[model samples]
Target chain A: MTPAIAVRGLVKRYGRRTVVDNVDLTVMPGRVCGFLGPNGSGKTTTLRLICGLLTPDGGSGTCLGEDLIAGRAAIKRQTGYMTQKFGLYEDLSIRENLEFAGDVHGIADLRARVDAALDRLGLAARQHQLAGALSGGWKQRLALAACVLHAPRLLLLDEPTAGVDPKARRDFWDEIHALAATGITVLVSTHYMDEAERCHEIAYIAYGKLLARGSAAEVIAASGLVAWVATGEGADRLAIRLRDAPGVTAAAAFGASLHVCGPDQAALAAAIAPLRGAPGIVWQEAPATLEDVFIHLMRQVPDNAGQG
Target chain B: MRGTLRRMRAIIRKEVLQLRRDRLTFAMMFGLPIMQLVMFGYAIDNDPKALPTALLAADHGTMPRAIVAALGNTGYFAISHSVTSEAEADALLQRGEVQFVVTIPADFTRRVIRHERAQIAVEADATDPTTTGNALAAVEPAVARALARELTGPLAGLAPRAGPVEVVLHRRYNPEGSTRDNVVPGLLAVILTMTMVMMTALAVTREYERGTMENLLAMPIRPIEVMLGKIAPYIAIGSVQVAVVLVAAKLLFDVPMIGSLALLSAATLLFITVNLAIGFTFSTVARNQLQAMQMSFFFLMPSILLSGFAFPFRGMPGWAQLVGEALPATHFLRVVRAVMLKGAGLADIAAELAALLLLLGLVGALALARYRVTLD
Candidate 1:
C-alpha cells in the first residue's frame, strides 16, 4: 500500500531560526503514528507542512499522494487537520459547526452525515448548544467530529487531548483507534507517554531533529539503555541525588520505587553502588522503558531554543 | 496606602510595556491626531473662493465684457468656460463642472442704453446651497459697479438706486436652498461608508483572533470564495440600511427623489461594494480586531470630513479636493445629491458613476492581493 505521507528533507525556517530542520516522515495507511517531542520542538509546524497549511522552506513531499506544494488544494480536500487549539467557531452551535465543515468539503447528504456524527458522539440532545458553552472534553469531541465530517482519508491531530481529563483522554484514544481500524491513517502529536504507547509506531523529535522512530519494544531495545529499580523506605528520595550523576541519564521516582537508566551499564551501576547496601533497600535489574529511551535520546541532542 | 501605590505603579508599568509592544495602536494614538490637525487646519475652508463660473456671452459688446471682468475681480467667480450657447452652459452647470452660469442676452448693450431694465440671467447650481450662497450675493454688487463704470456720458443716468442692470439670480434645483435636501441624501453615503466598511473590516480579523482562520484555510475553500462569502451578507445589510434611510429621508425630512429609483439603487450597490472591498483590504492588513477598527476609523475620518459630506466639496483647497476625489464616498455623495435633489439623469452623473466603478476595481484588486491562501 502507498504511504499516506511521504516527505523528505522537510525544512521550515522562521527568519534566522529553522523550526523544522531537514527532517523526514512517512506513515503508511491504517496506522496510528504518535508524534512525540518536547515543547516548541516544531511538532505543530511539521504537522502543518504535511497538511499543506504551511509551505516548506526547502523540501518536497506528497500528502495523500498529492504534491505538498503544487497540489495543496487537492491535499487539503482529502486530509483532516485539527489544530492544537479548538479551531471550530465557538459562536456556532455544535450542529452548525459540523454542517459548516460538511459544506466546506461539499459532502453529499450533509444533514444525515451531521446527524450520524452527532449521534455517534452522544451530542444529539445538545446539538443546539453553543460550542463555547460545552465543557473542555465535549468541545474537543465536537472538534473531532467536525474534523472527520468529510470522511477524510488521513487525519492529522495536533495535541488533541492536551487538556482533557483521564477518562475523556481514554475515550478519545478509543475513538482514534476506531477510526484507524476503518483504514484511515492518523498522525497524532502528543506529549503523554501513555498516549504515545497506544500508537502502532512512535517518532520522537527534539530541537528540530527526529531522534527516534520505531515501535515501543523496538525503540526501547535500540536505545542501549540499562535501568535499575530501587524500592525501600526512602528509595524515592534518591532521585534528586542520582539525577545529576555523571553516568545516569534519567532518574525518577514512580510511586515508592526509584527507576534509573543510562547508556552505559557499568557506569550506571557504579552511580548506584554506594546505595546498594542500604538497610532494607532492594535492587533489581529491569528492561528500559519507552520513556527511559526517550529521556536518553533527548539528552544526546543540545537544546537550540531561544537562538531563534 | 503605600502598598496600594506600589501595586498601581506596577500595573501602570505593565500596561505601558504592552502598549509599546502593540506598535500599530501606538502609532495610531499619535498619527490620528496629527492627521486630523493637518487636514482641518490646512485643507478645510468654509467660505470657498475661486468658484468656477461659465459665461455665455451672446453680446460681446463693452457692457458684457465689463461685467465679466468685474465678476472676475470679485475673486469668487472664476470664468473658466466661455461658451457661445445657453445649452452648453446648462450642460456645464448640470454636470457640476461649473457652479454658476452667466448669460448675457442679445441686445443687452442696446437695452442698457435705452434704459430698458437690461436683465442678465445668472443661474447658480444650488444643490449645495452653502457653496453658491456667497458667490450669488457677490454677483449683484459686482455687476452694479461694472454697469456704473459703463454708464458714463449719455448712459450715466441709466444707473439708478435699484441698478440699471437687473441681475436675475436663479437658484436652480434648490430654489428654497433647503439644507435637508442636501444633507439627507448625503447621509446615505456617510451611513453606508461607516457601517459597510467597519462591518467587513472586522470579518476576517475576528476569525484570525479567534484562531478559526487556520481551520478555515485548511479546508478546500478558495480565497475568492472566502472573500465573497464574507462580503455578500454585508451587501444585503447595506441595502436594508439604504432602504431605511431613503424612507426616513422621504417621510421625515421630505427630501425629494427626483431621479430614477432604479438608478439610485444601482449606484448605491456599487458604492456599498467599494466600501466593503476597502474594509476587507483593511482586515487583511490588520493583525487583530482592534487594529482593524483603527484602520477603519483612519479611512473613515477623511471620508466624512473631506468627502464634502459635512463640508463643501468645491470649498476645499485644490490638494484637499484631490484627496476627496479619490474617496468613494465623495463620488457617492455627488451621485446621491444629483439624483435626489437635481433630478440628474445617468448622463449627467456619468462621471461620478465611472469614478465609483474605478474605485471598486482598485480596492477589489488590493483586497484580493492581500488575502493569503496559506499561513506563510
Candidate 2:
C-alpha cells in the first residue's frame, strides 16, 4: 500500500521568505513519526500544511490518499490537530467541553461518545470539574482526549508536552504509541530528545531545513561522530580546554561527567589521549549517544544553512 | 451543512452557558436598560411650569396689585420678589435668582387712562432657549388680562379700545405633550440599541482573543453557521431587553403604545438582527476584543447622534440627515417611535422595514465571507 502521507518538493512561503523550504517526506500508517526542530523551524508549518490548516505555495502531496490542495476539506474531516495552547472553554466543565467537541464533529450519540472519551482518558472522576480548575497534567489529558474523541485517522500534535511534568509526558507518549498500534498515523513535534528517541523514526530540522531523518540509531550511525565520556575532579576544567582543541566540535557537561564528541576518530583519539593522563581526571572512549550525535549534527550545519 | 448546524447549536449552547456564569456581564445586560429607563424618564421634562420671576412695581396702587394677581394666576410664573426699584430686579436677574424681571412703569395708570399703548419691559435670560421662550410667551396673557380688566372696570370710560395680548405656545409634533410621554418611549430604542450592538460586537471577538475560537473553528463548520450561532443568543437577550424597557416605559412614564405591540416587537426583532449582524461582522474582522469594542463605539456614537434619539432627525442638515439614514439605528428608531406613539401600521412603515432588512442581509453576507475557519 502507498504510504499514508507522501509529499515531494513541498514549499510554503510567507511573503518573500519561505517558511517551509522544498522538502520531501513519507510516513506509513501505524508509525509514530517524531518531527524535531529548533525554534522557528518549519515543523509546525509543515504539519499545518499536511493537516489542511494552510495552503502551500508550491508542491503536490497526497494525505490519506487525497490531493493536498483539492481535498483539504476531506482531509480535515479525518484529521485531529492539537494546538500548543489549551483551547477549550475554561468556564465549562470537562464533560461539557468534551460534549461540545463531540457535537462539533457531528457524531451521533454525542453523550455516549463523550462518556466513552472520559472513561478512556481516566477523566471520569474529574468530569464535573471546570476545565480552568484542572491541573496542567489533567488539562493535557483533556486536550488529548478532545483531539482523539472522533477517532481520527491521523493526529498532528504541536509541542504537546512542553510544560507538562516528566511522568505526565511519559504517560502521554505511552498513549500515543497505543494509538499508533491501532493504525492511526501520528506526527508529533517535540523539543524533548527523550521523546524523539521514543519515536519509531525522527526528523531533525533547523532553520527551516531538514538536516537529518531516520531512526535514532540510523541517524547516529549516519552522523559518524565518535565520542568519549569522562569523569573526575577536574572534568569541567578539562572540558573547557578540550573545547578549543582540534577534533572537538561539541563539549558538553552531562551531570558531573563531560561528554566530548568529534567527527574524526584518529584526530579525536590524539586529542583526548593527553587528557586521559591529566591529574584528577579519567577518560575512556565510548559509543556516541543520540544526544552526543545530535549535538554534533547541530554544530556541523552552518549558521545560515537553511536560508535558501 | 448538517455538521455546520450541529456545531452551531453546540456553540450557541456553550456561549449561553458561559454568559450565565459571568455575573458582571449578566448584570450589565439586564440592569442597564432599567436604570437608563428610570433615570431618563424622570430627568426629562419638556413642558416646564412655575418659573420664578421678580416684580418691580413703581406705584403701590390697585393697578399694580391687579397686574401681580394676574401674573400669579396664570400658573406659568411665580412672583418670587416684590421690589421697590428697577435696580432691585436687575440685581435679581444678575444673580441668576430670577429667570425673568417684569417692570411696570411709574406712569402705568396714566398711560391706561389716556388710552395710549403702554409697553411693559420684560427682561429675560435667553441662555436656556426653551425656558426663555416659555417665559416670553407667558408675559403676553398676564399683561393682556390685567389691561383688559382695568379698562373694562375703573378705566372703561377713559379707554375706548383695549385689546389683550396673544400668547401662542408653539409645539411642533406633540402638542399638549408631556415630556415623559415623548422621551420615555424614545429612550427604549436608545438603551436597547447601545447595549445590544456593544454586547454582540464583543461576543465573537472576545472568543477570538481568548483563543477559544480555535476550538470553535476546528470543527467541521461553515462561517455562516458560526455567525448565526454567535448572534442567536444575543438576539434572545435583546428581546428580553426590549420587553423590560417597554414595560418600564408603561409603568413609570405612563408611555402608551398607540400602535400594535406585535408590530413593535416585530420591528425591534428585525432591528436587533441587523445590529447583531453588524457587530458580528466587526468581530470577524477585528484582531482583538479591544479593537472590536472601539469599532463598536465608533459606530455607536454617530448612530446615537444622528438616529434621532436625543436630537430631531428632521432638524439635522442635509448631509447629516443622509449620514443618519445610513445607520441602522436611524431607521429602527423611526419605526419604533412611529409604531409606539403614532399607531402607524405596516403600510406606513414599509420604507423603514425595507431599509433594516436590506442592512441585515448585507451585513450577514459580509460577516460570513470575512470569517475564517482556520488560523490562516
Candidate 3:
C-alpha cells in the first residue's frame, strides 16, 4: 500500500532557527500515527508542512501521492487540517460553520452533509447555537466535524484534544480510529500519553528532531531504560531524592508511588540502591512506561532552543 | 493612597510599554499631526488662482486680444485653450477640462468702436461655486482696464466708466451657485469611501484576529475567490448607501440628478469595488483590526481632504493635486459631479471612469499578490 505521507529531509526554518530539521515522516494509508513532542518542538510545524499549509525551506516530498510544494492546491483539497486553536467562525452557528467548510471544499450535497454531520455530533438540536457559545469539548467536536466534512483522505490534527475532557478525548479518539478503519489516514499530535498509546504507532520528537518512532511496546522495549516503582508510606517523597542523582534520568511522584527511570540498568540500580531498603517502602522492578521512554528520549537529545 | 499611587504607577508603566511595542499606533500618533499640518497649511486654498479658461475669440481683433491678455493678467484665469468654434468651447466647459469659456462675439470690436454695447460672454463651469466666485468678480474690472488702453487714440469718450465691453457672466449647470448642489453629490463619494474601505478592511482583518484566516487559507479556495467573496457583500452595501444618499440628495437638498441613474449606478459600483480592493490591500498589510482601521483612516484623510470633496481640486498646489489625482475618490468625485450636476454622458466622463477601473485593477492585483496562500 502507498504511504499517505512520505516526506524526507524536510527542513523548515524561521529566520536562523530551524523548526523542523531534516525530518522524515511516513505513515501508511489507514494508519493512525500519534505525533508526540514537547512544546515548541516543531510537531505543529511538521504537520503544517505535510498538509501544504507551509512550504519547507529545504527537502521535498509527496502527500497522498502529490508533490508537497507543486501539488499544494490538490493536496489541500484532499487533506483536512485541524489547527491547535479553534479556527472556525465563532459568530457563525454550528450548522453555518459546517456549511461554510463544505462550501469551501466544494462538497456536493452540502446541506445534507452538514445535516448528517450535525446529527452525528449530536448537535442537530443545537445546530443554531453559536460556535463560540459551546463548551471546549463541543467546540472541538464541531471543529473535527467541519474539518472532516469534505471526507478528506488525510487528517492532520494538531493537538485536537489539548484542552478537552477525558470523556470527550476518548470519544474523539474512537472517532479517529473509526475514520482510520474507513481507509482515512490520521496523524494526530498530542501531549496525552494515553492518546499517543491509542495510535497504531507514535513518533516522538524533541528539539525539532524525531528521536523515536514505533508502536508503544516497540518504543518502550527499545528505550534501553530501567525503571523502578516504589509504593509505601512516604514513598512519593523519594522522587525528590532520586531526581538529581547521577544516572537517574527522570524521577516523578505518582500518587503514593514513586516512578524512577534512567538509561543503563547497572547505573540506575546503583543510583537507587541507597533508598531500596527504606522502611515501610516496597521497591519492585518494572518495565518502562511510554512516559518513561519519552522522558529518556527527551534527555538524550540536547535542547535546540536559543542556539540559532 | 500610597498603595493606590504605586498600583497606578505600575499600570501606567505597563500601558507605556505596550504603547511603545505597538509601533504602528506609535507612528500614527506623530505622523498624523505632521501630515495634517502640512496638508492644511500648504495644500488648501479657498481663493484658488490660475483657473483654466478657454478663450474663443470669433473676432481676432486687437481689442479682443487685449481683453484675453487682461483676463490672463488678473492672476485668476489662465487662457489655456484658444478655440475657434463655440461647440469646441462648450465641450471643454462640459467636460470640466476648462473652468470658464470666454466668447468674444464676431462683431465685438465693431460694436465697441461704434459704442454699441459689445458683449463678452464668460461662461463658467459653476458646479463648484466657491472656485468660480472670485474669478467671476474680476472679469468686468479687468475688461474695462484693457479697453481703456485700446480706446486711447480715436475715441476716448467711448470707454465709459462702466466698461466699454458688457461682461455677461453665465454660470452654467449650477446657475444659482447653490452650495448644496456641489456638496451633496461629493458627499456620496466621501460616505462611500469612509464606509466601504473601512468596513472591508475590518471584515478581512477580523478573520485574522479571530484565527479563522488560518482555516480559510488551509481550505481549497483560491486567494482571488476569498478576496472577491469578501468584497462582494460590501458592493451591495455600497449600492444601498448610494440609493439612500441619492434619495436624500433629491428630497432634502433638492440636488439635481440630470444624468441617467443607471449610468450613475454603474460608476458608483465601479468606485465601490475600487475602495473595497484598497481595503483588501490594507488588510493584507495590517496585522490586526486596529491596524486596518488606522490604515483606512490614513487613506481616508487624504481622500476627503484632497479629493475635492471638501476643498477645490484646482485650489490645491500642484504636488497635492498630483497626490489627489492618484486617489480613487478624486476621480469618482469628478465622475459623480459631472454626471449629476452637468448631465454628462458616458463619453464625457469616460476618462474618470477608466481611471477608477485602473485603480481597481492595480489595487486588486496588489491585494492578491500580498495575500499569502501559506503561513510561510
| lDDT (Cα atoms) of all candidates against the true structure | 0.86, 0.82, 0.86
- Which ranges in model 2 have alpha carbons more than 4 Å from their true place? A244-246, A267-274, A292-308, B59-76, B79-95, B145-150, B154-173
Return whichever of 2 and 3 wins on DockQ.
2
Q: Quote the true-contact fraction of every model.
A: 0.64, 0.61, 0.61
lDDT of 3 at A176: 94
**Deviation in Å, model 2, residue B374 alpha carbon:** 2.4
Candidate 2 contains a number of clashing pairs equal to 0
Q: Per-residue lDDT of B1-376 in model 1, one digit per residue for the tens?
A: 3423332333233224334554774564345333433343345545577999999888999889999999999888898999998889989999999998999999898888876878899999999777777788888889989988888897777775674787798988877666667776877887788777877888779889989999988988777777876777668767877886788677766778999999999999999999999999999999999999999999989999999998878999999999999999999999999999888999999999999999999999999999999898
Looking at model 2, residue B215 earns an lDDT score of: 59
TM-score of chain B of 2: 0.89
Model 2 lDDT, residue A59, Cα:
85
- What TM-score would each prediction reach against the true structure? 0.78, 0.92, 0.78
Query: Order the candidates by DockQ, highest first — what do you get?
Result: 2, 1, 3
Chain B TM-score of all predictions, in order?
Answer: 0.60, 0.89, 0.60
Q: What is the C-alpha RMSD of each candidate to the true structure, in Å?
A: 14.3, 3.1, 14.6
State the lDDT at A92 in candidate 2. 92
lDDT of model 3, residue B363: 89
